[model samples]
Target: MAAENQTQVTEFLLLSFHGQPFLFILFLLIYLATLLENSAILALVSLDPHLHSPMYFFLSHLSCLDLCYSSVTVPKILANSLRPQATISYSGCLAQMFFLMWCAGTECALLALMAYDRYAAICQPLRYAHLMRRGLCVAAAASCWLWGMLDSALHTLLASRLSFCGAARLQHIFCDVPPLLRAACSDTRPSRLALHAASLFVGLSPFLTVLASYLRILLAVLRMPTATSRRKAFSTCAAHLVVVALYFVTANLNYNRSSSGAWPVVDTLVSALYCVLTPMLNPLIYSLRNQEVRGALRKVVGAQGTLRLHS
Candidate 1:
């Protein structure tokens, strides 16, 4: 009982964008809206059969990833908004780090899968069916989880070696690797190297994959016979392109830099967009833009109303 009690770290301290009093309400609105919109998208995708496709398969997973990614930081920030002081236990911090990395890594792989799906659809329409079959979709989604798990496992291992001997305060909003390393009490060279390697493997690799896939997609789109077909394909790629750009910009800034603090607020805001709004907008951007998704949504709503009336 004593050992167990001693081992259980109670809470963690969160540093907001910058101890800002005015930002709370704005952040609250953003978090609330993101949750609402992302939730609706996920519900609609699951309920509407017509929305089932390689695109939606990827979209649904992205919705889920957004839910998770946003969840890591926002609730705590909201709580801090309501309270004057915010704190978290060591265990809670560890859990947050694990889960956040898990979701982020998964998003990396999932995005790559989405790009591949687009590549297949645009570059090889005749064989898209055989290529992106139900089994393949499931396997691709499973691979995302596996990759995330692998990332989290290695990170956790590296983090355990760190000792919390210095200032307990974490500067960032969440328990990110660099900030966490700054707080560690003991040597963290191994952990830092491990994190860098993981970044290259889990983060940079996906960016390259998406880039190559999009390059091919663009070439394929250009070769299309009709203007309408080109427009439709570009539209499909547009939202993803915007979202991916947002993620890579913020993420690369946050990670790729060795040391910099030119604009923390701007960085925080961009990070929040990738972590929060991107996830929120993914389903809406994709589903609303596509006619098939809207048709599916209508059918689902109609079916539900009919069922309720009959009942």
Candidate 2:
């Protein structure tokens, strides 16, 4: 019975914010800005030999993840904002959810890896080089991507099996797990449990690891002799902490919420913050707050200027 019902849902109607032209335009600008910002950071990291360390290696990957993360949903959002009604095929919806989950999971792992890198730099300065060697960094990054894809595949597979009802309208902007589970006529217990477990494995567990790393870092920073050293250490961790807090808080709130009621407005707003706002802000936070990134940007700009002058 459920399988028969599942076959009926050909496509899903995504909730649109197009009626508000001002909001649509604002989102369009944000989408473009996120892409450009992440792209610039990625290019700068790749081209500059000064940024060829473990820290910048992770930073480059972070930029790539942010770019890919926003790309998963933002283009659809921009399209939806311009049209009267927005719809996605069932397979397309599943694909979107899969990629989004992949990015989200990978980000969680990367953040934890970054925190560990910071911990080594601050507390184990003597062994920083040995601890975060090129081989280890590459392996860690590869693990993040590989594990994330596997996690996402699990969620997407479970989601694909669930039988969706005839009502093709999704209350939220995208085909997220929570809302999609709510649309299913089949027993969603297994899917919800899988989601919760995956969240813990990919989200909560990594967050806890990051928290522990920071706690250790804080202890080390306090023991430093000079105020300048302490401040520098704190500054290094601060931007990352802010990004982590924003991402986890919004994601946990939305994903862990009871799926009984369909709150389109609330869901849309929350999704916008994580899916839209976070990606836009990530490059800005890292570039503006971190002197190293700023210096690299300046060098890039200066080099461009010199090249144009010669030409």
Candidate 3:
């Protein structure tokens, strides 16, 4: 009987601020800024010899992730916001969700890895090079990507199996597991359980790892003999800490909510912060706070100006 009632939804009506030209413009600007900011970071890290270290290597990957991450959903949202009725084909929605989860999962682990990198640099300064060797960094980064892919595959597969029962309206701006589970007419216990488990391992565990790394870093910094040394160590970590707090706070709010309740406005706001705003903010945060990045940016801009003069 349940199988008989299950309907094939060819497309989903995404919750969007449809017909609002103002919102369309706003999101368009945000997406453009995200692209430009992340691109600059990627270019600087790639071209600048000063940024060729493990820290910048990880940062370059982070910029790439942010680029891919925002690309998955923001463009669609911007297109839909201009339409009378915002819609996404069934397959497109699933694809969006897949990449979204992939980036999110990868970033969680990557941030933790970055935290550990900082911890090693600050606490074990004499052994920093040996600790963050190139091979280890590459392997760790590859593992982060692999973990995200596997986790996303599991979630996407589970979501595909769900029967929507003629309901094709998603109560959020994007296709994500929690919203999809809500829209599913099928028994969602398994999916919900998977989500809960993922929340712990994919989300909370990495956050805890970052927390532990920073704590150890804090203890180490306090033991530094000179105030100048302590200040220098703290400065290195400040930007990353801000980025981590912004990401985890928004992510926890977006995903940790009760699945039963409907709060479209709150859901939209949180999701925007997590997926849209955070990516744009990350490069800006690093550029503004990190001296080496700023210096690299200046060098790149100066080179470009000099080239135009020659031409």
Give the winner by TM-score.
2
* 35 Cα displacement, candidate 1 (Å): 2.5
Question: lDDT tens string, model 1, 8-108?
Answer: 43455666634565787777777777787667678888887777787887887887778878889788766765665667778778888888888888988
lDDT of candidates 1 onward, in order: 0.76, 0.86, 0.86
TM-score of 1: 0.88
Task: Please give each candidate's TM-score.
Answer: 0.88, 0.96, 0.94
TM-score of 2: 0.96
> Which portions of model 2 miss their true places by more than 4 Å?
259-262
On TM-score, the stronger of 1 and 2 is 2
Root mean square deviation (Cα) for candidate 1: 3.5
lDDT of 1: 0.76
lDDT of 2: 0.86
> lDDT tens digits, residues 1-311, model 3?
55554446789988889877887888889999999999989988889898999988888888899999999999888888878888998898899999999999999999899888888887789999999999999999999999999999999988888888775789988889888888888888878888788889999999999999999998988898999989987876676687788888878777678843377888888888888988998887655468898998888889999999999
